[model samples]
Target: MAPLRPFLARVEAKTLLAVLLTAAALWTFVGLADEVAEGDTHAFDESLLLALRSPTDISDPLGSPAIETAVRDVTALGGVTVLTFVTLSVMGALAIRRHGRSALFLGVAVAGGQALSHFSKTFFDRPRPDLVPHGTEFVSTSFPSGHSMMAAVTWLTLAVMLARAEPRRRMKVYWIALAALVAVAVGVSRVYLGVHWPSDVLAGWTLGAAWALLCLLAARWLSRRGDIEPERGGP
Candidate 1:
């Protein structure tokens, strides 16, 4: 076998470094969660409470009724439901249109990430915080918040798909940034409404981001293997 080129070696090193960093962060988060579970909730829970309390005085000009209504509407199944359905539908449609092995890889990546999120939630089984009034009733386990995880996974997946679909750098940045902002907002909302602890949100973010990266890597690998063609249309 021939020796690898210097540039290729550097690229491989950088990729390995990134994977290591991600793994370390994930391990740290898991350890933090474990510590919190052992009655050291001061670290994450207290910080979140302080942050949420600071914004309490900033009144929503619309009043409690309007605020509640808006929150309810946003958090309602219908709001994100439509977005989710539309995104997945488009991905499926595109995959069929492409009809390649790469599409199979993309499909698995997206679906597997979703399944992993659900599995993680069930494994954690941590309860939601009762410190503040919950705006919406929820019954799921709290650690690694479902809303936060799902938001990150879905939006990030869409962002990846959008990036792959387009070649313009500016458009790619805009699409990814918008998706990221929405995901972060949804995660923050969970804490603000007292439905999830800060640790839950943090874990959700860390794991969700890692999962998205993994999915993107899978897509890239498939593309390299000539299993799927790069999307040429504007996203």
Candidate 2:
């Protein structure tokens, strides 16, 4: 109890909050995954899938073609090629700015997330929803939507990077809000396209959010320990 005080003293309130939130989200994801695997979520997943589609035709989606095309574009924002390009581009920018630590951090955070997403899919081995015709082609197991995870990772990572450089509180808020919107859009697009179960997107969101927050917490700790520079103006 006495030694706990010293450790607790070193952690900031916000860091502690992030840790708690991350734990809560991660546990939620785990619970959902277990239930999904046990088939408890089958009824709910199918119901939600049907509710989001045209009542008359599962093949025909709910939106206009133009809107469907727009959703595809949004979903593409989380596609492998797009995320890879965005990751390299942002890391390149960080390196050019001489924020080597930040560049490395971003690289590991995203790459790790990709690997984790893959591992989760393989582990769960959940098939994609077949109740409707898929709007986009995909080639992976589907317990968790990869697009949803990547969207959260890329957008949230960029949001943190940009927010750190912002001095104004509102600017930081704006970046975070915009990032959340994009992430949510990607998840919704997955369900709308009939490529993923609603639970898959929920799991992806929870896992991705937890992972991003964990990375942020690591960045904060490393900055304090002089292992990495803070993102005050640099990385």
Candidate 3:
């Protein structure tokens, strides 16, 4: 019993951090939403969105055509088709590994995140940036960039699962950091493409991160109760 005290302490600390981070993300989202609703972010959004384009010609993006192409490729990582493929592939792998429960959980988390993004866009009904020509096509209203939110949700959820399957703390951090990097890149791409305001990307990143953390916490709780498989070599 005494030997397990340190392990329990570590678990508690991690859980507390997750909770605090989730709360912070949610709070930030609310603040951003309020600012957007009140049009307070208009100046900031326009300046940043315009900065990505050529000063003399707003139609052309700042970089060479190659860079623009590369950015478009990166942005595609968050597109519906790409994200859906990645999600299905990961779920399939999990099921094949005999972790059907985790696969189902992954599907639920991603689907819920998608629905949240969709409904939020509909609710806000914010127009896409009109400051410059949009470099890509878009269909939904653009309060929260769907690409940014889903990138975070899908990649981060997968990262959490990958981290769970590993026992090394360093590896866990690596997976999560990589996921965050990808999410950030996707969000920035939305702005660079002039399809979404900077605030829209910010809102998406925060809300998506909050959702992913909530799912991670839920998975931990379920694992503790033996409702799901525990992390590798975890108590």
Candidate 4:
């Protein structure tokens, strides 16, 4: 039988890139947090606020009602809850189908990201925006948005899983693109709705991506160790 040369090569490259990116993200996140601690408030957060408050001389063609509705919907469920639930549920289903190892990896990755988000919020205790009307009421500390983090982690994790499933080449690319779009859209929505500062969303995405990559690497290691067998008709 011929070896799956292309498949193996892709996996090696993906894993290496994931690790490098994850490390870079962590370094950037730490540096940003330190800057914020040193009272650097002129970052993306302030800029985003300015953009939101900028006058729209020309009325939005979509109208205020449409914009408001979209904002309300996006901020309805906090990003954390929505992403966590979706990722966990999908992982759980996969586990039940005998892909226990992959599921475990997913679970750990999400949990780690959540923990980091919570800790960062507590550490920074950054206040929520009061300059604009918030579409939804929330009381969590707001440095790094939980919703943004979850959205990134969940969608990125799914993308990694899809890539590993050995699906059709075109389909794999489509899935990865779709997941990336959703993750970005969710983060942007949080900012547009005045629920999270732009900096918060940016930080969330960085941490989320880092966590997902770490999780994928861990999952790959487990698979090699015979700890996580691919499911029948998997991916």
Rate residue 42 of model 2 by lDDT: 92
lDDT of 1 by residue, 112-224 (tens): 76687778888878867766666577877888877777776667766777677667878888878987887787777776666778878777877777777666666666666
Please list all clashing residue pairs in model 4, or write none if there are none. 79-147, 80-147
Q: Estimate the lDDT of model 4.
A: 0.71
Q: How would you order the candidates by TM-score, starting with the best? A: 2, 3, 4, 1
lDDT of each: 0.68, 0.87, 0.91, 0.71
Which 10-residue window in model 3 sums to the lowest lDDT?
226-235
Evaluated at residue 87, the lDDT of candidate 3 is: 89
Give all TM-scores, in the order shown. 0.78, 0.93, 0.93, 0.80
What candidate 3 gets wrong by more than 4 Å, as runs, is 1-11, 233-235
- Residue 178 lDDT (model 4): 78
Between candidates 3 and 4, the lDDT winner: 3
In model 1, what lDDT does residue 196 have? 79
Per-residue lDDT, model 4, residue 91, is 82
lDDT of 4 by residue, 22-85 (tens): 8998897777777666767556676666575536521221237687687667654446667667
Q: Which stretches of candidate 4 lie over 4 Å from their true place?
A: 1-11, 54-63, 76-81, 92-97, 230-235
Tally clashes: model 2: 0
Which digits, one per residue and each the tens of the lDDT, describe model 3 over residues 105-216?
Answer: 8999999999999999999999988888889999999989999999999999998987787788889889899999999999999999999999999999999999999999
Candidate 2 C-alpha lDDT tens digits along 77-108: 88989988888888887778777788888888
